[model samples]
Target: MAVKKIGIIMNGVTGRMGTNQHLVRSIVAIRQQGGVVLSNGDLIMPDPILVGRNEDKLQALAEKHGIERWSTNLEQCLADPHNVIYFDSQTTVRRAEAIRKAIKAGKHIYCEKPTATSLEESLELAQLAYEAGVKTGVVQDKLFLPGLLKLKRLIDSGFFGKILSVRMEFGYWVFEGDWQAGQRPSWNYRKEDGGGIIVDMFAHWRYVLDNLFGNVKSVSCLGVTHIPKRLDEQGHPYACTADDAAYATFELEGDIVVQANSSWAVRVNREDLLTIQVDGTEGSAVAGLRDCKVQHRVNTPKPVWNPDIENPFNFSEQWQTVPDNQNFDNGFKVQWELFLKHVVTDEPFIWNLLEGAKGTQLAELAIQSWDERRWIAVPELSLGVKQSDAVEASK
Candidate 1:
């Protein structure tokens, strides 16, 4: 019967993903739904203040969303006791500094990945948050995707009995700014700006492999920059220093082998921008962003090798589509709601800062593997700062 309003400082929301996914599709949509309903008939409404560098952009975004608060000064917003949560969608290079400030201000944290460009800094943030005793959550939105949800269902039902391997294909060709404007920001191709497909996509892959199939045991990755030069936002050509593509193979705890090819410089010729095909002993399934199709061992078609003539079997038509069993909300919004509940009543939220750090760790190792052209072992992470260490941090 009671409505509780919580304040959130949404930083770097003027960016593309920040504006569309986190702001419009998530926060704005949540407000439109009359806020997140908590158990015991209570409602939790988010009062978000959009914070960015540009005043005009922030003001325009706020006005468009029917929000009254927008701030150019993040410190000023962080100092306010009303704003209890800090959400960052800033560039990889800028995220840690802002998060450190927010943690110092004693605000709960939620943000997009990779949390830091390096594993050391990521671990430090996780440890700091633990010492501060602040509730934290990271964006593991892919796990909540409808297609992945169906894939999870299949895994749980023994449909893929004794799962073996997974093949993930993810990419879309980003236009160079010569004839057409690039789809992504220019910073995405600059190594100095914390940009690379390995760093970016390995973050997502780590949790997906860990949570769904098993914890990653080892990784062998190869990364490259396909496009040497690309036009920046202002049509100025700049040399690309970061890896635009990554081909990675992972060994999971249950002996599951996962192969992922992530790229920004390749053309798509698939059902979705991202698709994962899971093959197991009993059955196999292919899942995209919204759809999953499966073929059981009994139903799978076998064809004799005849490359001389056209194949007789309708390979694509063999699989059956997975039905949408229930209404699915936006993945980002769903995670946001869970974090809100966690902040409110200590709900069991698992995707904390350490999980985010794990993503960064995977990315770091992937890059290292690519550089060395060798398989790297992934050690289990159990991070906590001692009371004395926390005291030292204070001094």
Candidate 2:
């Protein structure tokens, strides 16, 4: 069996999500597992060069991971022909320019979500990559979560026949950093830095809804900045100009309604930090980050309405737990492996730049809907190259 080495220039991986999810849990773990095995018994090994603005942090991260390649010069790394792929996890405001540079350097691109702050710029990047004939992808990691996987299985098995509506409650209280440090980066609360829950999370909801339920037809949203001020990493106070919470309603292709409440100021009182409840004709399911519970029509308890008498039904006990029958890997790692395979073996990868642009479009419309206080119609995006055709063209 032969082994192939693929050099990846990993940019902005020193940040929290970049370091923990993409680098440590995904790429580094793949390296530790002897790389990805191909169908023909060949091995595709990843050689990552850590790139960031800070030399000391990049060097330390590289050394900690037993990696030898570390660079502070992004242009130099992009100029290197050996590095065929450029991966970015930079701040949202900085991603477009960096990705444009990488595309100009003739590198395949992969990166974290909300590819750009606006739909126009996102589509521009997608068009540029398509014209450049480079393999491109954007992160849609939530679809691979174990809980969502089980939900998909249920949907495929007809457990929730003729699904009607979906309710998603996703959020956790992020400290304002006056007394305690905030869990997320300070930039996440600043609009000038491309920060907002709608921009950050509505992109996720768009793909999740489109993939699992149906195409979104329209949207109505309300955005809020619950916390007016917060302390930054340097313990200095700053005004919070971005929306920390979003309450959005969506209408799907099949008349299925979806209501999602995403917030950073809400306390967690549910089974997990995130929970999705789907109600259908035959049954209903509530899936958290890791566990799923279901209540079928046959097993659902019936209770009589009595205002004067004591209620005796145990609401939470009626649902049955979904068993863990299969082993699940980290979501980020799974996508990383797929992307690596797509790059080397010309495998089909559906989550390309166009899909990323679609997500950006959803967020853009949602914000507009909120600002206008009216429903916004979601139009189908027309890409120059169909995604499936692009895959065929690559082959």
Candidate 3:
């Protein structure tokens, strides 16, 4: 069996998410596992060239990972004939321009979500990729998480009959860079730099809701800057121009009500940083990052409500943990392997740029709902009409 090496130009590797998840956990992990095996017994290995602005960081990352290639010249990397795919994990503001340049170079695209700051640019990139006839994909890593995977298995097994509603709680307290250093980049709190909880997180919510439950029909949302001022990387206080918290209610196709709260200021008191509770007529399930617990109708407890009397029911003990019968890999690495196979062996990859545009569409509608303080309908996204066209067409 032969091993084929597919050169990948991975940009924005110096950043936290880029460095930890995409590079180390995913790409490097895939390499260590002997790459992805193909249908024909051949293996397709991802040969990623780390591309970033910082030479020192790039060199250090490459050396630490035992990678041979690292470059600061994105243009030169794109120009190389050997590189078949261009992956970007840059800050949201810079992603569009860089992806456009890569598309112009006729390379396939794989990148992170909320593809662009606006719905117009997101759709534009989708349209451009369609015209260019190049394969494209966006990271939808949450779908591959072990907890969510177990949840999917339960759904498929008819454990949740007539599923009702989903409640999601996601977030943790990020330091303000005053006493302890901020865990997230300071740009995340600045609206000018394409930063906001709604824009950042709604992408994940859109895909998670659409893929597992149903397509979002409408949204009612409230966004707020809970902490108006936070210290920057330099420990200097700056006005937070973006929403630090978002409380959103989404209506899905089956009339499922999804209430999601995403915040960076909230303290952790739940089972995990991200937990999704799915309720149904027959059963219910609560899923965290790596574990899932479920309660069936037969095993569910009934408790009497008496405010004056002390409660005796152990609510948390009623559910049983889902077994990890099979080994689950890192979600990011799993997705990378799938994308690599899709590129080399023509495997089907459903999470394309258009699907990503749908995410951007949801985020935009949520923001609109927040601004208008009313429910906003999610219009079906198609190539028949563009956001830019509607502006001039109205006049």
lDDT tens per residue, model 2, 1-395 = 99999999999999999999999999999999999999999999999999999999999999999888999999999999889999999998899999999999999999988898877778788999989999998999999999999999999999998999999999999999988999999989999999999999988998999999999989999999999999999999999999999999999998999999999999999999999999999999999888999999999888889989887888999899998799999999999999999999999998988899878888888888888899988878767755444333222
Query: Which lDDT tens digits does candidate 1 get at residues 1-395?
Result: 99999999999999999999999999999999999998798999999999999999999999999987999999999999999999999999999999999999999999999998777788889999998999889999999999999999999999998999999999999998999999999999999999888888889998888888999989999999999999999999999999999999999988999999999988999999999999999999999999999999999888899899987888889999999999999999999999999999999999998999889878878888888889988877767654344323222
- For each candidate, what is the lDDT? 0.92, 0.92, 0.91
How do all the candidates rank in terms of TM-score, highest first? Answer: 3, 1, 2
TM-score of decoy 3: 0.97
The predicted structure with the larger TM-score, 2 or 3, is 3
lDDT digits (tens) for residues 1-395 of candidate 3: 99999999999988998999999998998889898888778988889999999999999999999899999999999999999999999998999999999899999999998899888888888888888988899999999999999999999999999989999999999988888999999999999999999999999999999999998989999999999899998889999999999999999999999999999999999999999999999999999999999999999888888999888987998889999999998898888888888888779999998889888888888888889899988866766576687322222
Clashing pairs in 3: none
Positional deviation of residue 361's Cα in model 2 after best superposition, in angstroms: 0.8
RMSD per model, one decimal: 3.2, 4.1, 1.8
Clash count of each predicted structure: 0, 0, 0
Per-model TM-score, in order, reads 0.97, 0.96, 0.97
Model 2 TM-score, 2 decimals: 0.96
* 81 Cα displacement, candidate 1 (Å): 0.9
Return the TM-score for candidate 1, rounded to 2 decimals. Answer: 0.97
